[model samples]
Target: MSMDTRNLLVELFVEELPPKALKKIGDAFAQTLYATLQSQGLLEKDSMLTPFASPRRLGVHITNVADQADDKQVSQKLMPVSVGLDANGKATPALLKKLNALGADESAVANLKRESDGKAEALFFHSVVQGATLAEGLQKALEDTLVKLPIPKVMTYQLADGWDTVNFVRPAHGLIALYGNDIIPVSVLGLKAGTTTHGHRFEAGLDPVFIRHADTYAEQLVKEGAVIAGFAERRAEIVRQLQEAAANAGDNLKPIDDEALLDEVTGLVERPNVVIGQFEETFLDVPQECLILTMKANQKYFPLLDADGKLTNKFLIVSNIRPADASAVIGGNERVVRPRLADAKFFFDQDRKKKLESRVEGLAKVVYHNKLGTQGERIERVRAIAKAIAAKLGVDAKQVDSAAQLAKADLLTDMVGEFPELQGIMGRYYALHDGLPADVADAIEDHYKPRFAGDELPRNAVGTVVALADKLETLVGLFSIGQVPTGDKDPFALRRHALGVIRMLVEGKLAIGIDELIAAAEQPFGKITAEHRDALLNFIFDRLANTLREQGYSAQEIDAVLALRPQRLADVAERLAAVRAFAALPEAESLAAANKRVANILKKVEGEVAAKVDTSLLKEDAEAALNNTLSTVKPQADAAFDRGDYTASLQALAALKTPVDAFFDGVMVNADDTALRNNRLGLLATLHAAMNRVADISRLAS
Candidate 1:
């Protein structure tokens, strides 16, 4: 190895890339190429890598890349010593044939080495292998990277002669590979390496920017071609322009925060120039969500918001060209967005004409799933489950049922039909238009709350009930039809629905029993649920366990609490807290180990142990001490448990540590006397029952 090094640059000019996947492709290309070069011993340990991605190109610049790797000793195993040599240790015919295959001959046998390979002696050929040249390594690296790219879809196009074709994300038009001031002469995607590439198709100062050196690639592209070649640099410029534009609009006003939109817009242009555009004020009457979604999704525009976070007629656009007379760009963008905003307004007005209540019948015609009947039938099941949950919550059943019945009505509305993401939002608006109560209307929308992780929960009690019912119906119905999620394939997003259910029950402090809800949700499905009810319940609990684990709760703590299958979902958090507190206690380890011993002893019994300990049968001092301690501590522990103070309940059992240890150390539970053994079993059973009110503390045993 030598200290000599040179900077390297590689570029692939192509047709416009998919904006959503540009960042990923750029990162993969740079990383994979760097890895391949490093594996080939061409890159130094301290080399720096910079990746560039734009609408029409992907490139990378690396510092401290070597011209060639160091030469290395090579070893070639020929054959076992017995096969390669005769009795007198002369070369055998097999050895001569193997030598010939390796470009050697019998004359080379004198230099061959004999070495032990495991237990067998083997004949080995040693030689020196030359390091790969830059041209050779870069060509292999480029072809490998192109072949292994995560292309969403590849386009096949012919070369200049039209006889051969290559498949790439987009047809590549140019390839550049430079080491210092010289070309590496690599080729890929049917394009030969070069020092020239086009940039900013419409606005580049130079028709073909020529790179004079490897380190000047970015500077050359920006200075000569009028393009911002770095993805991060381009994105930062867009953000700065957006902030400047929004600040100029008014005080406290800002552009909507959408990272995905910003990234996509960044990938769509080589040069960015933010321009403010405005639509007519009349279109503002439609819901701001409808307007904003259309602007961002359809036109890639950033909708401006006022101080109070309300959508205004003004928006911002990122254009590739910056013209001196900017009126045309602004006007063209405004005109392009007007029809989109007008379409949103039309859907809003036409949808309000028919109340959400009127659209309820339309749901009957829409099939939810081929196996689960129509949306109308699903709504009925959700309503039934909602009413049951409402009754348990002591809420108004009529309001909950009404909310559930019309929750999916917006699916039939023109606005929601056009934008499926607006289903519940539009439902809320239409429900309010029909003069429904605010709570009912809000619940119609809130039923879809917490649609993603870390999202907000339903805003009110009624909303909570409906959301539960909606999610429960999906879980039970899907499980009944055997459409349960397997591996990573959750077509219906059952995992998300399950998490939603868990979040509502635990976070809302609702005392609804999971088993009761599952049973109620399954009643409408008839025998389909009868066979799969257990599996569905387990699925829900599994989601609960995973959620707890993600929240940083230890696996042992979750197992201890969940093993009991607490009927009320709201009590799980309290029990987990108790287990954590109990584990931190000084006596927790001994008591946990003793409890485990008790469990194993009791499990081996032929029949259930009746928790009826006779005082007279307890003959040993340790047994008597344990019985007396239980008599004293059981009341305190039970009292704390009955009052919902789980921490106190678990802490109360810490007093029995000494007696429990003594009992296990001094008494034989399997006694020669049958009466004494039964009585001992009874005592251990009582201890088990008392200790596990909060959780199975035995799970915490070492």
Candidate 2:
């Protein structure tokens, strides 16, 4: 370490921060501070940054930060020489005015240099700019960084004086700014720099932890404050403690893996102590998902599960303080959670008393969308769409109709009203309780499958049909009303709905075409414009192109296959595979180029070009040779295409490379003789049609 440089530390101690936004705010604080300092030349190339964030504080430690930045040689451009100086080469009023504006006087004119600025010569002023002191630079960086922090929401609170107020993520109580062992004297949010900060409201060994040095902040806080100062470190410790507690709880018992819950709990405490608590076994009769959701969402508890992944009555509590005997802590947590679990059980039991069908009428009272009527009307559309899809897929239509009718019934249940995320899940349970068919029950839940990317699709054929119908209806209905997604503002998640439709058709390998499905979905909406239908189709294809790209296919491959707008999305993968295989052949490049040329030639003809070529007009040997090659190869390619061997079909075109090159090299496609030109155009048209059956191979041309 240089004698002139030392590590710097800055911390803002405040009341509890929003746990969901704590990590993001901490990272932004450190990164922006480092960037601002680096831009001012106050940091060395080797300087390092370490961020610290807990429930109560956000801090950063930076190494090799200088007390003052280095001086810089700066150049300033004045007006053009013609405007700033007379012909006698003496100072003019404009020159003196410019010099004075730059904190200079007429004396500076003698030292000013003349330089050419591209088109004209200009007067330039040069000076050595003094560096900024640590105090000045740190103050600016602190204020700038605080403003840039991604605060979820700000709270306005009065300062100690009771007159002045400040807005911050939380009420700021203290601030610490240290350069090595000396205070740098920076302030923010009505708080002055200090070395003392409180930790672990009740468990701290010291009422105010004294940080002695910049580099010792974390260690000092841990020793005297009874707090873990690093967010990641605290989270890892909590994980370790939870694992140990779960292992000791019982055989094959493990806490549920929920990263979001873990992070939220980590932000809720400065010091973590994991303890196990259990509710009555009677609560287990309710669905485990309900129990787990209540524990994690309502109480931020980690529910433990047995070997078969079934929820046990036991759960883990991440308390902020640890006492010698934890029995009371465990008992208190148990007492607090019993009422929550009892409420869940009561909702489940009450919901099942009346059949799901009874609530179907209540859906009429719920407005789905102002333009689309009520949930009851939407259910009828979904039923119509689902029945059509079920018929196309050769599945039982009666079960699909029943499932669609009851799918949204759970939305009226008390449990679903409290937890909207459990809508489809509660429907499944209620359907099973009402003695619906097992496939119908499963389909009720599975219809909402593949809710997000990489999420699983519907489990059964019945579920698959309903899911496709549901997503399609949403897409067609919203699109009809012109609620299309533009840029990143997909308020309706139309992109996700479109991708879901693509996944079902492509992944499920259904025989249904995208157009046919959209048409079926639109049928229930009465009359939809051709414009809306076309717009929706384009949207789906655009999403499919992106999906194919994410799956690792190149843009050219996807464009070539999607160019034809293949109705059956399931055929896209096969076509792209064929295009890739055909691209690898040694003759692929030449053939692709020839195909491009052929398309351009066919596009220029004024009238329709026939695929049938007149052999009598083939006066050139190259044209005749090409014509003979197509006769022999076309049948073989057609046979392969007929049986779904796209790769073999595309590979058959390899033989035409030599003949195609010869025809394009020697033949005159647009001859002065009209008869000859039309015959050659017909030949190219035939070639274009055969080559592009799988994909537009011309797109593969470099």
Candidate 3:
């Protein structure tokens, strides 16, 4: 009635799984399990389920699943009831056998209620269905679902001949499938699955032990000195161990916030082993970012700090094996990582010897995009775009040009070559080594801002200019080649580029239209032309609306701005903010209602003649007042538009409220007098022009 309250444990033992595969596999397993349980009619909130993966195995734990499925009542249709029978009511020979079988089969149908035809020759019956146990259903589902589970890249070893052909990311060594204390015997990919699983590779290899129950699995690993499952638990243990080690060393471990490292270290070990390792303090002279990158990337170590809040010469290493002597383990890890630091320090020293500017000549030989040009050519274009954008944004023109010139110089650096992740990072270091200005170094570093959603933006104007240049170049290049992001595949990250452009404008408060900037950036591209003009504009404009709406504007609001074809991004944002704010204004509500009436009146004169408002034929006091109101608001709206204060313009347009409402209610917009009707159409044209100054009010709903 509530929950199964039974724990389900499934562990698929393998030789080892890659760290990247762990997340995907674990997610799929949890999703499949939850989907099965939910379909089996269990309430998810009352149930708990989770999955964990490590280098050796994938394990799942589910608690309090509804033990039994909710009772099911089904109704079955019997062969249309009249298709096989005649009006005479006697069972035909063909139908007699079908009826006799149904009558004797009690399991197929618990009860059958027959309805007789007027001729009494035929009988139709509805049968009752018997409920089945959820446990039995789950077992059957597991049987059918295994082959469908996603293991995108498979590695096969040590099974039957066809086992090598068996599709899995890796070889399956063992399986532990349990519900409460019972084993669900499921054989997948030639592995005889059971409820019991062993802890750690050594114990599983040495003793061939089996776990008999779900509740015993976690503690069994504990007895084997294993912290086998949850990452949260593993991370907590690492922190506790690191804190104690830090206390002993008279330093505190300042966290570097490396989630990727934490996850990798989590899977690399079955047990929590925190080892404090050290290198020579001279290595600390290397840039902290470079040092951290080296330690985390190559050595898989976390650095520590002195209580003074600076990186210490020490680092903390999380090991899979806890040695019999703690010092011996710490010494071994320290020995391994010191050599990595040595190599990094050597690279740093060797790189600094040659000025970064001297390295500029080497990028000419490296290709950026085959169709586009060499990385050298790209650097030139970027410098141009940056200079232009910088000039527009009132940035120091010299700094912008210098930063753009040096931005791609790091691509040829040995350090960047060794660590592909350090492209922009290496540039900053190189710029400083070359004696370039801080603004130049900053632009090199900050140009990659808003790399992902919610990432930090550039703090300096020089960086902002370079960022915009970089984004526009990529967007224009990709669109020129007709390879825009189609349905989620943004190989070039064009969506990200567009969003970066938006962030640049919104965050920098830069008052330039995205389309104008994109067009200006594309002017240097020889491939873009007038024939595909609308296509290019649509591509950029549509993305802006999509990105803006994602930041949470209503669909109508998004359409309303694009309708205005704004030239400044600030104008678009201002208009949108104004429209949303205006939607709640009392005059806005009345104006929308009046416009709705105006639209309805226009619908009747559709096939007759175009109506234009005539100044001389204005007989209705309502019409005169409405025309006066438009005249007064027109100049105010124009002034507001000029200053980029759309809110004021929108408020000014609200002046037409009373007259517009009264004109629609008291006068027929279309009359037998076509001149008067035409005059009214002219009035609407004026209103449309007025509304267009702020937004397309026609797009606004009543």
Candidate 4:
């Protein structure tokens, strides 16, 4: 009964879990228990679940669980009528044997019913199956749930008996299963079920908190155990303290928003106490990025920011224990963070002494990839590709060259060697210190733009050129060695590189063709076969199509536009828009069908159709009218296309619909006369070419 069910609680006490994976494991544990109970027909459809996770425990409380499942009727097929009965409709020996296996005898056969099962008649024995009691069902549910948990790493430890060992995420010490106020008999992981569990090791007021009832678990833990048992509630309290601390500091100050850091910190503490700490102000001389990275990654501290969103010397630390006097905790955290800030400052000062250009020679010793040679060789290839692209786009070749040459030079710096994430960022700072041009300095930092999906592109032309060169070099070099991505294994990030190139080309409206860029990238790696080049080009197009589909474009519209294989990606969006507009026209369906017919006819021809059509051989008025209409509409469409007005170009073809329909209705293309048939084929060829200039409109056909 939905309205008569009671709340159920289950908990597992173990050693401290992995902080990063605690939330996931807790969620999985709660969900699997709920699903297992629901599958056993012991829970109503609308039961609600509340999950609790802390450093040492995983627990869940479900509302509206049942004491026992409803009884059901089952129909068991005993045997076919032929084997169960003799010719005179009397029971046979086989019938007696089958009934004994089901706890029935010869007397039950008289009550059995005969029914037709497909091509044969079978005897069916109907019975009522008893429902499962709570104790019987919960034992199976608990054992199966422990097996299905998503344990990141398992440890095997001997139980207290010293004769048995069990494997689990951590060493399990206790388990609790309660149906209302009474304990349900259940055992798992070599531990017996109970109504009591321990709390925080140091902060709990009671050694073993007595859980009086299932519904009062959280309240009892907080009042008697001094632990906030609910995971989400604890995280919210930490966030509140962080906000309040930042507000008290001064004007324009706030804490960084890092969900991952918040989750990890939440998993590490049961009773959270936020304390403020400060470092020496001179450490601000280093880049704020370096300082912030060191504090968050090394010490797990939330660095405060000023009115301009600049990192301040003050930060917040979430301590697990709350002592009455907080001076010791604050001082200890402050002392621990000073050395990390000092190391960052030292690396910054040491890296600035050498110019960025001076480090390019050191890259010769660093390996980029086992098959792709060294970082120095990769930089040379990138520089060559950038210059070639610059020549095509009419940009200053020197700016692109300079940016490419210095892009990978930061790999040799002390700051970057310590933190590989600071590669391009340090290059920009070093270039500025060397008095390089602003455009070149910015380009050095922006070459890795659009690193992930929905990221921003390079800000200027030089940056764009070098970014494209860098991504293309990686794609072409990796693809040449047959390291192409398959299924979800893109270890080298080639798919991301392909998407980056597509974004720059389409979003920036660059005039560069994908084929031409591939050619330029391939030239630097001499003797790459044509097959690899083609495969790489197709990979780029596949990524483009998938990206477009995700942006809400229909497959029909994409196929119509991509069927033409347009070389200039800058025009793809407009072409897709033109196709969509054409598909909405009243005459689009008829015209598309005609194009499909013409394509099939042309495909069947053995030789190339002649270009010239003899006007005298046009006997039917339909052919003559179509030829006349093409003469008038072809030029207007061609002019619109040349001027980049794709919609107008597609619209110009609307005027030829009546003539096109008339020709198809009255003429037979495959005629007996050789001269007349050739002339007719040439006419259709002209129409096909004119219609496909903007996109393959036939793809819009149903």
Tell me, by TM-score, which candidate is best. 2
Off by over 4 Å in 1: 74-128, 527-531
Best by lDDT: 2
What order do you get sorting by lDDT, best first?
A: 2, 1, 4, 3
In the range 37-115, model 3's lDDT, one tens digit per residue, is: 6777643455676776667777777777655666666543454345544576444555556656766432332344455
TM-score of each prediction: 0.96, 0.97, 0.86, 0.94
**Which stretches of model 3 miss by more than 4 angstroms?**
1-6, 41-45, 50-52, 64-73, 76-82, 89-138, 148-152, 158-165, 202-206, 243-253, 305-310, 530-553, 571-573, 596-614, 666-679
- Inter-residue clash pairs, candidate 4: none
How accurate locally is residue 443 in candidate 2, as Cα lDDT from 0 to 100? 95
Per-residue lDDT tens digits for candidate 1, residues 1-702, read 546689999999999999999988998889899999999989888999999999999999999998889998999998999999999989999999998988888889999998999989999999888888878999999988988778899888898888998889998899899999899988887788989899788888888998899889899888889899889999999999999998887777799999999999999989899989999999999999999999999999999999889999899999999899989999999889989998999999898888788888988999999988999999989998898889888988988999999999999888888999998998888888899999999999999988999999999999999999999899988898888899999999999999999888888888778888887787777755456888888888999999999989999999999988998888998999999999999999999998898899988999889987999888999999999999999999999999999999999998999999888889988999999989999999999999998899889998
Question: Model 4, poorest ten-residue lDDT window?
Answer: 1-10
Give me the overall lDDT of model 1.
0.91
lDDT, candidate 2, 493-536, per-residue tens: 88988888888888889898887888899999996999999999
Ranking by TM-score: 2, 1, 4, 3
Model 2 gets an lDDT of 0.91
Worst 10 residues of 2 by lDDT: 1-10
Clashes of 3: 19
lDDT of each: 0.91, 0.91, 0.73, 0.90
Q: Tell me the deviation in Å of residue 467 in model 3.
A: 1.4
| lDDT (Cα, tens digit) per residue for candidate 4, span 150-197 | 888889999998989899989989889988988988888987889889
Model 3 residue 192 lDDT score: 68
Compared with the true structure, model 3 gives a TM-score of 0.86
